[model samples]
Target: MGLFSRRRDPESPAEPFQFTVDKVFVVPVRGVVCTGTVTSGTVRVGQAAKITLEDQSRSVTVSRIEAQGKKRSSAAAGEQAGLFLGGLTMADIPTIPGNDGSIKDGDALSGASVVSVF
Candidate 1:
């Protein structure tokens, strides 16, 4: 099946958590923060998740979740929030390709989706 064509089992016990990255920012002391709207299911602080970018994907543990400038234990679909991710840096994000073939541009989280949670 295609990426967007994938669907969840309605009878499943829990809905799969899905989030699309709208923006990524670096905090002075919080490391990398990803801001977006939860598209499906629910996400909790300390939850293990996967971030997929083009042909690459990485495992990430959610350090914290924030909504409306307040700390929250969890967030559900339709909630706009910022998630502090563990072990991710600005360098990990794809950027303009360098002379050494190390840079990759058009690396955005626009259509990225978090379809599941561990």
Candidate 2:
């Protein structure tokens, strides 16, 4: 292949949908939103996804996807985006235990993961 030529691997399979959550916040009208980068594959609005947080996991419906402050129907790998999850509230997130064994009363989804897309 030449220096400027692109190589294609026909034997390689496509990647599955995956995202690493960086932050989670609740909006008054939009409910819970998870903001992160889509690491692989694609995610679309209205698709069902599985979110994993530490040892916990929950199924949620994708209500909206936003990138660069604009709403989009779908998001692909390498895009920094936010996914609005339906039927999720701040109360549903698991609280981290403090050093004293008390539940921390702040943002509980800082390190969550969108493990699967369905």
Candidate 3:
């Protein structure tokens, strides 16, 4: 092995899952759904995560996942998916501190990143 090519430790913790939001949807009774592409690691149904937008954050659970209009149990890096954020409604999503409106339109959530919580 070369000096710069150290072997990965099998016992090491997995990388934290991350997904970048491309859009946001607020379903009347099913909770908020964020559609985007997974940038790293993997996320599964029931997984806990934190959504960070600017300086605001929210803890949520991955209640469900879908891709290509089909239901999915998990999503991995490079895949696009819609993640249902369980327990959150439109009222729970935060807006910029001084902004005048809540994140109602999908465009407001663009570029937000969701990271898995240990």
Candidate 4:
């Protein structure tokens, strides 16, 4: 399948990883912290992923995963957690398409999509 294709292999039972960002916080010690729900599949620390915002997509790594103040090895669909994104910074936050640098909320209007690259 193509990179952006949603088609799946019937023989494979794995669900594609997809996370919808609810809010974004840039921690001083940590990297970009994205709080959201796991839409599908599972994601683990050290896994590569693509953070999609509108027409833009950036490569990043899952540095850490936590839920309810407890660190987790992986998070599955329907679960809510905070994801520490590696290789990204405050400057990487998605801004309004044509506005003067206003950040977009993680809502359906223009939310961010974090999908596993592999």
Per-candidate local distance difference test:
0.76, 0.77, 0.84, 0.79
Q: What tens-digit string does per-residue lDDT give for candidate 3 at 1-118?
A: 8889989765434457999999888877778999999999988888889998667788889999999999987888999999998755786555544476544667678899988999
Error of 4 at 2 (Å): 49
Clash counts for the predictions, in order: 2, 0, 0, 0
Could you tell me which residue pairs clash in candidate 2?
A: none
**Candidate order, TM-score descending:** 3, 4, 1, 2
- Candidate 1 lDDT, tens digit per residue, 1-118? 8877968655434446888888777777788788889998888777778888678788887898999999997889999988888867777666655788765343366566654564
For all the candidates, what are their Cα RMSDs to the real structure?
Answer: 12.3, 9.2, 9.9, 11.5
Residue 14 Cα positional deviation in candidate 2, in Å, after optimal superposition = 12
Per-model TM-score versus the true fold: 0.72, 0.71, 0.75, 0.72
Worst 10 residues of 2 by lDDT: 8-17
What lDDT is obtained when candidate 2 is compared to the true structure?
A: 0.77
Q: Please give the lDDT score at residue 43 for candidate 3.
A: 88
lDDT of 2 by residue, 1-118 (tens): 6899988756333335787788787778778888999988887887777887567678888899999999997788899999998867677766677787655334567656775563
Overall local distance difference test of candidate 3: 0.84
Clashing pairs in 4: none
lDDT of 4 by residue, 8-49 (tens): 545433346999888887777887789899999988888899
Q: What is the lDDT of residue 111 in candidate 1?
A: 64
The regions of model 1 sitting more than 4 angstroms off are 1-15, 96-107
**Candidates by lDDT, descending order:** 3, 4, 2, 1
lDDT score for candidate 4 against the true structure = 0.79
